[model samples]
Target chain A: MVAFIGQLGRNVIHAIAKLGDASIFAVSTLRLLFATPWQGKHFVMQLYAVGVGSLIIIIITGAFTGMVLALQGYHMLVKVGTEALLGSAVALSLIRELGPVLAALMFVGRAGSSITAEIGIMRVTEQMDALEMMAVNPQARVMLTRIVACAIALPLLVGIFDVVGLAAGYLVGVEMLGVNSGVYIGETIDKIALTDVYAGLTKSMYFGLLVGIICTYMGQRATPTTEGVAKATTQAVMICSVMVLVLDYIITSFYL
Target chain B: MIKTKGLTKTYGNVAALNDINLHIKGGEVTVILGGSGSGKTTLLRLLAGLESPTSGSIMFSGEDLAKISRKRLYELRLRVGMLFQYSALLNSLTVYENVAFPLREHTDLDKEVIHTMVTMKLEQVGLRGFEEMMPSQLSGGMAKRVAFARALAMDPQVVFFDEPTSGLDPISAGVISSLIHETTVKTRMTSVVVTHDVQAGLDIADHVILLWQGEIIAEGKSNTIKNSDDPRVQQFIEGRPNGPIPFSRSQTAYVDDLTHKPGCVRLE
Candidate 1:
């Protein structure tokens, strides 16, 4: 039991060291960000790939989730003679918690895993070393692009999620659930101030940056072995997922 | 010119390289010969600044590598090109894009100039018209030639080859060796190749250094190596099993064990 405690302490220290290393990586990433124009093209392309590619899923999931929340909230509120408060409940959940966090989590799994695998394979195959030899900074072109792309992309994705989710809730509550259309739409509009929407967007931005930086760092440091790329890809996805959840909690407590 | 002093690299308790001191001059093809565990790749990586030496200094044109910033190191790297043993071509890029990659990154050259240079390099390596093919589509020799063309794309002053001719047929190997000779003459470049192919070294090297047990045991020009009196050198060049380096058994131990069989347990 003592040995186990010691091992756990050692592991915690190692993790803290890794986090410190990650902070240094962010510095290098900043250097890469300012150094090359290749980063511009790469950033735009990765943004398009991550944001546009995931558009359908984000919209569908947002719409259905909103509809289900509205249906349930209205039905439950009617039993308590407070069905008119349904709009605030759906809008609150969508803006304060669900929209940005869920969308960011989904993008991490989709975009972050691919970036990790691609970069890991590049490292193992010596393409990264070849880039260094060629006087081309791989970090600038690869990592910076992904980070900036995600920073731009995740907010836009969250906007899509927010508006689509709101629209879906409005439709279900007004047209299908027999709530007065004007009251449902007006109450939602009144409850969702700029602060709510902007806060969600801000959370999305942080999540996007987090996902890109962590995934790229893991990929670049992958071991040069046959299984290393696969392992990096898996670890990137797992870590990004957990980080998105944790950040969601922190942002929710702060913002909401 | 490149030089290393007391270059040592240790992995935990194991010394991959031990106090290696060497000088390589301009306009020479120096081959470093060694087996798998002999630290040839580690030496190259240390000089290339991909890995730092545990203790030593690497000086290129009198510039201390440790003192230079990464940007300056990158500038220095523009003068050095390395072709990996596996021909590390970017899979997503075609041969043309791969070769043109360095030029595009480092130079202000427009697309027209890059195209012209890429074509010229491909033609130099006799890989013309394969520019559109991906690295996965190329044969091993073809891939190696493509890698060579990419290395030559920047017209680097010093080129390093990590087993450039590893998987090629004899004919292709000859082409590559001659191409190295031709490119070096055409560009007056310094070339360093690490390989265990003794015949290839003999055929192309202006100078050769043999690495054993993390140290250089022999070094000379090709002709000097062939006629050298050192027994280990002779054993290596002649591909002999019996010499200073025993094949599978030490001579004293083998004789003693032979004499001390159960029937003749008392050799004395």
Candidate 2:
């Protein structure tokens, strides 16, 4: 029992140490944001990889989610004889909660995993060492560019997801289900404030930063092996997904 | 010039490289030769500042690499180049872009001048007219040559090669060995190569450092290493199975293991 407790204590210490290292790595990369000789080309490339590459999945997921929400919400509001509230329900649910959370989760599955795998492969193949030998700071040239790109891309992606979701909800609630189109549009516009949009975007921004830092940290710390790369990719997706949901709850609680 | 004083690198309880001193001269090819688990690559990484030492110092022209600031280390790294064992060419970039990468990053050279320089370096490595090819499209030897071209792109004063001929056929290995020799001589750059290939080491090396069990067992001119009297060096160079160097790492007595019955006590 004593040995078990001692082992548990050691494991806790190790975890804390790893967390501290990751924090330092994140702060150092953030410091490089204003450093001279910015990596404009690399940043642009990463924007294409993380943002544009993720557009199709986000669109498909967002459209389906909004349509389903409209259907369920209409059924519920009809029982209460307040079917006009369907638009307000769908729009509020999406812009305030579902939009940023689902978008970030999808981003984790797609872009975040890819980023981790790419950096992990580079680590295994000694390309990171090669960059260091060339006097290029991998943290600045590689990690910072990808992190900043994700931060910029996530908000834009969330905006697209929210817009598409609203459009899908309109199609389902008004055109398909014969909820009065004017009432639907008017209620949705009246119910959603600019503060809700800001709140969702704020959630997306934090999710992006968290995913970027976690994925890059895991990749950089991965052992130089094939198994290591695979494990890091899996962990990046899992951890980022959990973090996005946990942070979403925390941020939503504060907002409320 | 590069020098080390009591340089050591340990991971947990295992020492990848132990306390050692070495002097590598400028403008010559130095070969670090050892079989598997001999710490040759660890020493090469230490010299390139890719890995820091645990206990001692690596001096590059009197500047201790372990003590330098990150900014200064970056400045120092700009003067050095390394060809990794697998070439490690950027998979996303074409050969032309790969060779031109360092130049574009470190210099203000115009595109026309950069193109000319990259072409010249590729031509030197006999990789001319293959500029548009991606790394995935190239063969192992071709990839290595492209990496070599990139390594020389910045006119670095020192270059490190880690197992330059590991995966090549004999003829391709000879080609790479010859290129290492010619490039070192023609460019007059300090060169450090880590390899287990005895013949390749003999072909290009002016100085030879033989490592065994994380320590330098012998150091001398290449010809002197070939004629070394040290039992470990002799066994390694001669490729002999029975010698002072143990073939197996097993601690149990070999004869007893072979002769004894499974679950039976040995009779005196």
Candidate 3:
């Protein structure tokens, strides 16, 4: 029991120290982010990387998610003789929660992991040191571009996921299932308020910031070794995914 | 161009460099000679201000690197360049983009001027037409040459190289060494080279400093180093397997490890 407590204490201290380090890194990124000479070309390239690279995965996942939700909602509602409510249930679930959360998770897996690995490899290969030697700040050049591009890209991607999901729900509910087309379309439109969409988008933007910070932070500080880069990439994805969900709950509670 | 007073660097419990004092004249090629773990790279990094010394000062370009503000240090770094061991070209960028990186970031020169400058640097390294190719497409020697071009793109007053001829075929090594020689002669920029290759070091270096373990074992001109009678220097330059520098027997008994003794089974 004593050894276990000692181990637990050590882990807690390590976690706190890492948290402190990340906080400082985030502050430095923000400080450089608002300064002059906004790396316009690099930002566009990163936008392409984070936005376009993850497009297909987001679309496929969004479509299947809506289908699954519609099918599940149909069965449960039909048992209660409220089958017409299927459109409302599917739209509300996706617009309020699944769209942003799933899209952020997918971004973590697809683009965010690669971004972390790239910067981590830069650290290992002495590229960061080279940048410093060249009188270029790595935080401003490498980290800021990816972080800001990620913050902007996630909302746009999440928006696309929401629209595709609504359309896919329409396909499953009206075309494949026996629901009335007009009613399904009508309910999806009427059930979702402007505030609901706003909340989801706000969550996505926050998730973008969270994932961006975690990835760049983990990557920029990766131990200078191959095993270190691999570990950092994995940890960036895992931490970003978990943080997004935790943040989703906290933000949802505000609306409630 | 560079001077160190009692310079030492230690990582945790291991001293990578210790108690080193040296002066490198401007516009001269100074080669730091050492074996794999002799802390030569550590000395070069200290000179470049990439890492701070634990106990002493590194006077780079007349200012103490460890005592300067980060802003001041960055400003001072503008006049310096370094070629890393692995080239360190951005994998995602093309060769042209890599060479032009420092110029584009630091100077607001006209695009046409930057273009001409990058072309000239590439031509100097004999990679003139390979601009659009990525670093991954280049051979090891070609990559090193491109990296050398990138390092010289800024026309730095002081340049450092970390193991320039390491991990290359003899022909490639000869090409790079000659390029270093020609560039130094033409530009008259200060050059510091860290390498384990004795022939390459002696061939290009006007002065030589032999580092062993974490300290300076010998210091003199290239001829003095070639003719030095110090056993450590002799062992290093002669490429002997045993002497003051044993393979694994100094730290752990190799025979005991072969015999699987419980206390002496480990190797460093």
> What lDDT would each prediction earn against the true structure?
0.86, 0.93, 0.91
Fnat, 2 decimals, each candidate: 0.76, 0.85, 0.82
Query: Against the hidden true structure, what lDDT does model 1 obtain?
Result: 0.86
After superposing candidate 1, which stretches have Cα over 4 Å from the reference?
A31-38, B169-171, B229-231, B238-268
Report the CA-based lDDT of candidate 3 relative to the real structure: 0.91
**Candidate 2 segments whose C-alpha is farther than 4 A from its true place:** B253-268
For all candidates listed, what's the TM-score of chain B alone?
A: 0.90, 0.94, 0.94
The digit string of per-residue lDDT tens for model 1 on A77-137 reads 9999887877888998898788988888778877888889888988888888888888777
Task: Give the per-residue lDDT digits (tens) of candidate 2, residues A189-254.
Answer: 999999999999998999999999999999999888999999999988998999898999899999
Which ranges of candidate 3 are over 4 A from the true structure? B249-268
Q: What are the per-residue Cα lDDT tens digits for candidate 3 across A105-216? A: 9999998999999999998888888888888888898999999989999999999999899889888988888899888878878898999999899889999989999999
Q: Would candidate 3 be rated incorrect, acceptable, medium or high by CAPRI criteria?
A: high
Ranking by DockQ: 2, 3, 1
Clashes found in each candidate (C-alpha, N, C closer than 3 A): 0, 0, 0
lDDT of 3 by residue, B1-268 (tens): 8889999899999999989999999998999999888999989988998888998988887899999988898888778889999988888889999999999888999999999999999999999999999998999899999999999999988889999999899998999999888899899999999999999999999889999998999998988988988988899999999888876646776576576776554554
Q: Which scores greater on DockQ, model 2 or model 3?
A: 2
Q: By lDDT, highest first, what's the ranking?
A: 2, 3, 1
Worst 10 residues of 1 chain B by lDDT: B245-254
Which one wins on DockQ?
2
